[model samples]
Target: MTTAPASGFQTRRIVESAAACSGAVVAGLSLMVPLDPRMMGNTSALEVSLTVLNAPRSAAAGAMLAVVAAVYAMIFGARVAWCASFVAASVLLICAIAISGPVSSGSLAIVNFIECVTAGILVGALAAATLRRPGVGTAYTVGILCGIVIGDQLQMPEAGAAMSRWRWLYAAAPPLWLSVLAVVLLGVGLYWHRDQAPIVSESTVISNVPLVPILAGALMLTVVTTTSEWTARYDFGAAGLVCEILVLAGAALVAALLLPGQDGTLILLATATASAGSAVVAVPHPRWSWSLTLAALALGFLAGRLRPAPLVAAGLTTALAVYAVLTCGIAHTYLLLPVIGCTATAFVLGYAFGAAVPHTVSGMVLGIVILVAPCMIVALRGHENGTVGYSPNWYRDPNGTEGLLPPIVAVAVTLGCTLGILLLRQLRPVTAGHIRRLPGRALGGKFA
Candidate 1:
């Protein structure tokens, strides 16, 4: 008897999907390049403000805009065209800006800010396109983790005295390369596939969006981020610690109440676990840290291929919990634990993100904010307390063991995620439909 050919997705689709997902790597690099200390030269304050503070805020705003635009375009049934046009415009602007030499701190900040916003759009677009597709989602998640590690690993070459022709070109090389690579991969993955009608028009699509929840979530994110930045950087003392906990709790509350059904819970749990896992790997060792990060990325990619179940993600999260405990307990005494933790945590983070890729644009945006907003607070707590795993500096790791509070926070968050995941498994679907249906529901659309 003749066997039937395997079907569901074509080989071309997989390749294209991988290419699209890999654009995330480039997007991640672009987000990180401005944060690199070497790239900032002497602009430390400017760098911190842009990279650590404004970057997350602007990216959150951009992602929200992406959600709106995607919804609007989908209503008009021109999502592909709209997304392509927006992406093309953003890429071109990024290239133009990346090639320009920074004349002053002010100008450099503006340039980097634009790049971050554009990169955010790229991220939002990628999530909208590929997160639901298992193979591509895996690739996308792995690419993101790799980009972070790669950006940290890459060293800028010094400006040689002998080369006098174009000094700015040498300085701007990394960002320029990143911009170009992103454009190429995105073109191959998403641009080329634009002709195919991927998103089907559904009669059940909600025309009137739930603006209240969306705005409420955005507001909560802004407050938490701004407060965290000021509190941590300004040394608010005990009050800061209390405020931090309150704000984080508020953010979570807003996420759960504002977003539909379990999506909020899902986003909160997934990103919290991923962020906690990252803290486990924040070592500054040049050689081993770099190699282990790459290895983790590779392992993550393989794990994604397996399309691990929620249970699998929960198991990996348990491993991170153990790592978090060890780091909090004896990381300072053992020294080598962080190195081992780096590999394990990074791989598990990748797997967890892949396994729980958000299904909605709002979920994606909220997840990003949830991950980023607490970073400064955690870093500051670690720095002040002299913890073993947390590196205060966003760019360069000086191997300073700031405080164990970071890992302790990580342990709490990871445990919450594991519990949430297991609980999610037992619950029936709570919502009427995907959040996409919320678009026109309030205004009495047919389905509403």
Candidate 2:
């Protein structure tokens, strides 16, 4: 008798199901933990740091586990690898607990238990679906169940800590759990369908030759440095704005380069970057800034539809201009005078550069980088001050004691810049006409 080949879809479905179940369990546990009010404080700088700190260590651990599981599946077969990895993780957890010492603090103990159980469940589920044999699935299931049972043994206090914190924690945990679950499901699907063959090689994926890690690292370092400074001074008005602009410019450059060739991927990455960055920036003027950023993104989409090249160029220019206006004089003393004049010069530069670049994704990326680099550098430097105010605060008075225009103006300018880019893109021609032939024609022409 011959063994039947496994279908990719079926394998993906199995992995996805297992991942979903694991995620559900983790999310349920997260809801039981208390929330930290400081995590959502008025200061964006404080809020951002707290958020990162609150993230379940399970997330990082799970990712590492997933990678190990993938390798095990390829080498020793799925079943054995799964069991071994699960056991290894368990042992490591125990060792960590021993080194950390018994959880003397009750709240800390409960939090640790929740994190551990969730991590165990996710790792087990991932292993069960990807491992070579069905038997190990039972072991993985049992291990997760056992971990949860142990978690219950930790016991919860009936009362004491602030209800507000608890409510916040309860509200926040489920989403984090859900996100981790989704990631697990995606990972399993990718792993299960490995036989379908990938467009890009694994080596290329791991190497990240396109400098994504470098960009991400730089952003992370910037956040950490900015956060530290904000903590020391508690003043992040000008500096925060500068950082926000630089981050936007850097993200725009990344989007232009990484996403130009791929529509769906580009959209996903761009949206994630934009949403996160906007959330950080929205701290100063939650209502107006948020509205403006959303509007800009919407207009960007429209511009892409009408004229991708010009829209790309415009985005690059706008990002740079924002950075320059915010930080040039303060941070870039040598280039300050020249940059102020080049504000107008950028429009001509964008137009010519957009027209000259090849209509390929790579060209679009290069153009965005060239357009934004100088501004980004200045913004990055300017944001070092630690003071951040989204918009000017105002006091109401019948006698005209209000000064609320700065924030409003910022939002309006942001919107206007986005719209201007859209107009520019709409006017640029799609010059890839020569290569726009039907697939069959192109293939035949190539062969001929």
Candidate 3:
């Protein structure tokens, strides 16, 4: 039998997948600068602490703009939107470097806000462009996760120190300039292959984006983010009840606006819980955590390729792994437990999210929000309020043992929610007319 030549459609898919993966890597690397704790916490002056530390708040504002950017990409075209976003982000980074020494902390914070907003637009565009194509979508997701890890590694003090005089090439980080150059080249390549469009189902396309719902979702994210940051920074008279209420209300609003029906609800809850649980297993030991994370990501990628069914299975496993990691012992003292727990959490959550990603604009927004929300909420609570697990107490040598109660409760609650949703779906009688016709299924893949 003769091997058939690849069709034009297959070629298009290949090109688009490569472009999407490249764009996602750049976006992830760009995003890390704003999200970096060292960058956020390190300030020029002692008195201007508040502005610098509140970078996450600016990131939240950026998330709001991300919604607008995603809509713009859908309306105009992903290529145009992505190029514009890349230029904007570049300008902001350049401006940030120019003003690093002379500008006030407040001005620096503003720069951070704009940079984050531009980066968010880039990310939103990439997601909107690729999420409709199965192969491209998987590539984008995996590329982003890997890029985040690589970016973090590159920003480490040792990596910067190795650069010596070359380190001064960029104000933020030595490799950042290289990342920008790579993005520019990638954009040029994308423009060159602009006509090579991937096969996308007509049903997945959003002719007229839902403005009201999108705006509502953006507002909710903004409020939740702002409230979370404020609550984290300063103690309210009574544990910031109003702020907590706002955060919860905002999350609920997002679910209402972005996630519509039963399936949507299931996706939202499952993703959020898994994300929160996965945040806990931060292997504090120097280089081990990074290596373990990469290995876990690789494992997850393989698992995702297998396309596990009943998507919640992976998420539930992730929660259980996290609980086990925490309850085992101090991660530093009992290295085996953390290694196992962290690997399990990353592998399972990776599979859960990678396989279950929906193929709609609203679903795209939900994915981005799920990634951001858990980190924000955990940051809001901090190690003091409770251990959502990401924020370790020790600055230099974190043991990863303190504050176990909260994460245990969180994972347990998530597990309960998953079971409850499954029970509800099974018990409730289905009617054809009662079902809402969403753009795509909650879980995307053979199982969905």
Q: Whole-model lDDT, candidate 2?
A: 0.32
What is the Cα-based lDDT of residue 166 in candidate 2? 39
Worst 10 residues of 1 by lDDT: 439-448
Residue by residue across 1-448, what tens digits does model 3's lDDT show? 2334457567667766666666665565555444333343355543234433554555565566666666656555555544654565465457545544555546655665666676667676666566655777677677666554444333223323344464444335324564555466546545754674333334664544456436545655655555555545565643454445435534543454344344344344444443354434444434446567667876775665466443365355546646644553555566565556555655655665554443355555544544443343354335363322134321212433445544543454355445544544454433576532224442222111
| Candidate number achieving the greatest lDDT relative to the actual structure | 1
Using lDDT as the measure, what is the rank order of every candidate, best first? 1, 3, 2
Tens digits of lDDT, candidate 1, 302-335: 6744674555766666667556656655554565
Model 1 lDDT, full chain set: 0.51
Give the residue spans of candidate 2 off by over 4 A: 1-15, 18-103, 106-233, 251-448
- In terms of lDDT, the poorest run of 10 residues in model 3 is 387-396
| Model 3 whole-model lDDT (C-alpha atoms) | 0.50
Q: What's model 1's TM-score?
A: 0.70
